[model samples]
Structure formats: structure tokens, C-alpha cells
Target: MGNPVQRPLPDIEDPLYQAHFQGLKDQQLRVQQCDACGQLQWPPRDLCKQCHGDRFHWPVMPDQAVVYTYSVVYRAPHPWFKEHLPYAIVVAELENGLRLLGNAFGADVEKIQCGVRVKAHFQHDEDSGVCFLRWVPTTS
Candidate 1:
């Protein structure tokens, strides 16, 4: 199958999401930590949801997580993902209590369920110099 002309990668140019993608490229999971209240959050925002703290730091999170929820997509919303139909989109809760959304592309979809253990899987695109964070079932 031909590769998609352009993959639907995250906008690395946006300052809000840059650090998260940079961490993935380095094989680390980074999240925003509020400097004011020490609150950890995902999908980095300009301010903390807890205390409305504008100052933050990007901290590398633990690679391990538990599958909080997931869904198998039978229909690909984008043509680029048509070849990957039936893949599982997962919301995994990190050890720090932050939930991050990822794709269980390489794992057996049937084995995915709530409470399953998973680990970070970084997929780097050489062409675009972009790194994507994925999740796969952990043997342990």
C-alpha cells in the first residue's frame, strides 16, 4: 500500500505541544508540571487547571501506565489511517495519575482491556522528523 501523502501528526510548531513531542523523540514521556502548585497535567496548556498557574516545567514521566479505556476503530476517519483499521485507541493512566491518549498499533487488539499494563512506544518518522507516542501491552 502507498504511504499517506501526509501523516496526521501533531503540530510540533505549537509551543504548547512542542515539549511533549520532543520528549517522545527522545524516547521519554514528558508532561507539564505546574510550578506554582506542583500539579501534573497532559495536553500541555498555557496554565494549570488546578491553580491557574502560568509557570510550568516539562518533566519526564514514567514509561509505565495502565490502560484506563480503549476503543477499536472499525472505520478510519482519515484516509491515511484506512490501512490501520481495527486498531485500538487507548487512554492510559500514567503512574503519576495523568491520562494520555495513544494508539495500540503493534499490540494485539483482542488483548487490550481496562486495567491492562502498557508502556510507551515511540515511533519516529524519519521523513518528517516527527516522533509519535504509542502504547503496547507489557509482558509483565
Candidate 2:
């Protein structure tokens, strides 16, 4: 048996995306919504892409989504990911039409396909107090 791999942690200190990380820690999915035009956006930004609004709010998003696309990585891109070989990376579209990218944990890489339903799965790191959002296949 070898030592467990330590995955890379995201920069939770980034102000623009802090809310998103915090939301995951709190077990909620948060996305940026333009306060001016009511547009929901991902990858938090300074200005709204839809209306160019400078003001925005963090709103909890639905956990359910449909897999828009996916890929099964047979080769690890980094040493930390070696133990997770053949993992599925998915891009799922939420009900609001917002797409989020995340790893499909506890999924059969060979069975993952487009149009599959998935749900958000939050994993918290005890050492760094960071929470990560993963996608998991759902029956319903």
C-alpha cells in the first residue's frame, strides 16, 4: 500500500469566487446573478455578461443537472491524479441553463454519457476547510 494522494486545492481566497467556495462549504450551490438584469452566470465575474451590470448577487442554484458532455481520462494529467485514472470529467447543465464543470465521482467511467442526469456532491477537506463540488449520476 502506498500513501494517499493529495489533490490540488482551489484558491478559495480569490474574492470573485469566494462565495462559490463558501456556498459549497455550506452545502449549497451558488452562482452569480446580475442584480440589474436578473441574469445568472457562472465562473464569477466583475461584470454581468448579459447586461454588463456591475452589481451582482450570489444565489443558491438547483442541485440537479443533465450531463451535457463528458470525457473519461485514461491518463493522469498530474501525479496527484494518478490514483484517479479513468475518472470521468463532466460538464453538466443546470435547469437554469448554466453549465458547470466537475469530476463525476463514484461513477463508472465507461457508462458516463451525454444527457445523463446527475446531482451535485459536495466534499469537504478537513485539513484546509475547503469544499469541492463533484457530480454523481442519479437514477431520477
Candidate 3:
């Protein structure tokens, strides 16, 4: 698992993930919650990985998370991310016990750290109807 030197191919959007995209536009961070076992998961899905449950719920996140790990990229393999090159990509543990992966926005390289508290920041792309959830350090 590494930042590749070439652009990863574009992915086909799954209709199942559209709900999650809409939730973000509503200013809510949505995660897949297992209707069977009550497990909250990111990367929206039609089935729960834990118990093979076909039902899931989209729950609003608590708006709080802690950085579990992070990586600072000095370069981006693709031009699309060039403006945000030298940024931080992080795995954050949400308050609801789900770990979410996203780019950490508004953070300085010298200030980023594991366990840093962050809050969800939403960006809407009307052209694509995509809502991205990035993170910004929260003031303690």
C-alpha cells in the first residue's frame, strides 16, 4: 500500500454509495451501520461484512474524530491533486467507533500528529453531485 507514481484509474460510481454522497451534502457524515449487529462502517455498502447482513443504516457522524495514522505526501502522482500536494492523508477514528480514511485539510505538516482531534468538513461538487468529507483540526 503506497502512493503510486501513476494515477490510479477512475472508478465507476456505485448507486449504493449515492446515499452516502447525499448525506454529506446535507452536512452529515454518513456511514454504513449494520442493522443486524450494530456495527458502523465506512465505505458505504449494500451488505455488512461482519454478519452477512443485507440491511444497513446511514447514520450521521458525531462530527468528531481522532487521527489514527497519517502520511504526508510531498508529491502527487496526478495533476488533479497537485494543488493539494504535500498534504496529509489520514485514517481517523470517528466517535462512533468507525475508522474513516480521508484527506486532512487545513493542517500544517509540522502540526499534524496521531491522536490529533479533527472535525468533518464538507465540500460539494455540484457538477458531479459528489460531496467529499475532508478533515480539519479541531480546536481543543
Candidate 4:
């Protein structure tokens, strides 16, 4: 892990998602929602999957979610994650009934379970200058 890129930065491949990154950059969690049918979606597509409409909106996500499913990665796929061996990649269901995926942020790696309740934590990376989201265990 010798100077092998300390962290991953946001990908600007699609302009539609720039608002998402910008939302995160400002410490607000945003998700894709339909302006037509009010359906929440992910991966930031051009059209709403439910209503088949092109009107999309990114609403600030709530602070809580339940772990839908998760997997621990022992072997660092990229060198940047080498220091964080056995980290968890989690998919959580939002209060609005949509699923989002991110690294389990502040929770103990050992106590991770399928139904664990977590609070969303947003932090700005000094290296990448980007705000990223992670999930931490919460009692309420």
C-alpha cells in the first residue's frame, strides 16, 4: 500500500449524478426519486423506472436505515482498501422503502448482521475532498 492511492474519489462519468455528489459534498444524503410517480430509485438513471418518466429528483435521504444484506471483503479488491481488511459492504433499506449500498462506516465489523439498525454518517475525505456516506449502528 505504498502510495497506492489512499482513497477512491467520486466518478464523474454521468452528469445526471453530479447533483448526487454535490449533495454529498455538502453533507446531505441524496437519492434518486421520481417527480412523476414519486418512486425512489438508484444508480441514477435518466428515467424513472416506475412511471417511465424523464423527470427525476434527488431528495435528501433520511438518517436511518436497516441493513438489508451485507458481505465482508477480506481480500482487498483494490490496494486502497488493503489497510481495512475484512470491511463490510452493506445494502440498507431506507425509510422511504428504497435500498442503497455503501460501506458499513462506524459499526463494529464483528457485530454486523442482516437486520441491524444503523444511522447514516457522512464524512468529507481530506484526500479526495469528497463527502462519503457510511452506516453505523444505532440504538434509536
Candidate 5:
């Protein structure tokens, strides 16, 4: 059978963050930034976290980051992720001033190291209509 460990992705319906989810579906990573300070914010907020400014805009990501920390899941506590055991759950520090949390594929647990370069990819769930952000090692 197809990957049994696959799980439904998020189908966020709220208009405030619909565009954020759509960006992932389009294979373009985006995050909200303060128009004033240019600080990148995660989870796409309506107002800047730093200055509480309501002038926020979505900016495309450069897709370049380095792993800051990670955990190798040898066993998933839930049935949905069992097949993907031993996956690398990584927190990547983006160059544009953000740390994104996602799964890292195509790398072994022993090979995972802080400062490893990575780029973004997407995984979609047809049933639930959710898109997930995944990462792959960057050659550069």
C-alpha cells in the first residue's frame, strides 16, 4: 500500500491565514513581516509582533536555512507517523530572521548536524487538503 504513515494535512479555513497556506501549496514559502522594521514573523500575523504595527505584508522566502536543532524520532507515538519513523524533526534558522520547524527528508539520523544547509519542499494530503512544509539538503 501507499505510505501508511501519511497523515491529513491542515485545511485552514480562516481568511486571516488562508494565503499563508496557499503559499505553501504554490511551493512558495511566505511569512509576514513588519513593513517598518522588516522583521520576519512566523504564523503570519496581522500585526507586527515587535512594534504592534498593523501594516504587515507577506514576503517570499529565500528558501535557504541552516538547521539549528533537531530530533531523530525512532518511533512515532501515533499511528499516522509510524511508517516515517526515525525522521528528522528540525528547526531551521532562515537567513531572513526566522526559525521554521519542519521535517527533514533524505538524510540519516546520524548525518543530521547543526548548521546543515537546507531548502524547502512541500507534501500535500489530498484527503484533508492540507499542505506540509518539508526540507531537503541544499547542495550549496
Candidate 6:
């Protein structure tokens, strides 16, 4: 069996982001932080550029967040997104000043409101063989 050509998946071979994916697989949101400086970083890196520390810190993301910004993806850049057209991608700001970019869970794409409360959640697409760290708006 092989992955579909239209199916998009991250290149998990890179160790820098491996822990991030592992954290998602475990249903936990984890961001890399500098073990030396205690500063969080994104997109993953080999060394903490802040202090050049080789160690990494994985902390569970807070349950509360607010939509810092968002966009409605009516046009998909990838073929896989075409099937799920009109999605909402949000930059959720956690209580700790960390921001996580994730797809807002649910079909009502128009319901995304800036400054709206949200929480982290995991979604697994069994058919596409993929997992996601999604953010769902909290019930008002």
C-alpha cells in the first residue's frame, strides 16, 4: 500500500519536529522551548538559537486560547483541501503568549470569530491516514 498522491503529509524524518508530531500523536500539544533560556520556538530547530542549547523542552499547551487571527480558505493550495473546501485556519494565542496555528474544527467555517475562546483538540483522519492538532471554539 502507498499513500495517495493527493494526500499531503509532513516529512516526519526530520528529528527537529519529530517530538512535535509525537506530541500530537499522543493527543498533547507540545511546542519546543529552549532548555537553557526557557524561550519557546516554532518550526523546530536543531539548537536553541537563543542560547545554543542542545536540549529541548516539551510543555503541554494550555487548554484556553483566543483567536488572534484567522482566514477563510475558500481556495485550497493543495488538492486534499479541495475536498474540504472553505476551511478556517486560525492563529490561536494561548494564555502563555504562545500562538498555535491550526485548523478550526467543525464545518461551520463562517463561525470563526476573532478573540473567540478556543481549546486544543486532536483529529485523526483514518481514511487519509493523517492526524491533526486542531483548535475548536469553546461553547458560548
Predictions: Cα RMSD each: 1.8, 1.9, 5.3, 2.1, 2.9, 2.8
Model 2 spans > 4 angstroms off: 1-5
TM-score winner between 2 and 3, please give it: 2
Sort the predicted structures by lDDT, highest score first.
2, 1, 6, 4, 5, 3
- As a whole number from 0 to 100, the lDDT of residue 96 in candidate 2 is 83
Report the C-alpha lDDT of model 4 over 43-111, residue by residue, as the tens digit: 788888888899888889887899999988889989878877878888888877777777863337767
Task: Pick the winner on lDDT between candidates 1 and 5.
Answer: 1
Clashing pairs in 1: none
Best by lDDT: 2
Each candidate's number of clashing pairs is 0, 0, 0, 0, 0, 0
What lDDT score goes with residue 130 in model 6? 55
Candidate 5, residues 52-118, lDDT tens digits: the string is 8887677788777888888878878778777677788888889865888889655465577898998
My TM-score estimates for the predictions, one after another, are: 0.92, 0.92, 0.81, 0.87, 0.82, 0.85
The predicted structure with the larger TM-score, 4 or 5, is: 4
**lDDT, candidate 2, 81-125, per-residue tens:** 777787889999999899998886454767889999999999888
For each candidate in the order shown, give its overall lDDT on alpha carbons: 0.87, 0.88, 0.75, 0.80, 0.78, 0.80
List candidate 3 segments past 4 Å from native. 1-13
Q: For model 3, what is the alpha-carbon lDDT of residue 129?
A: 60
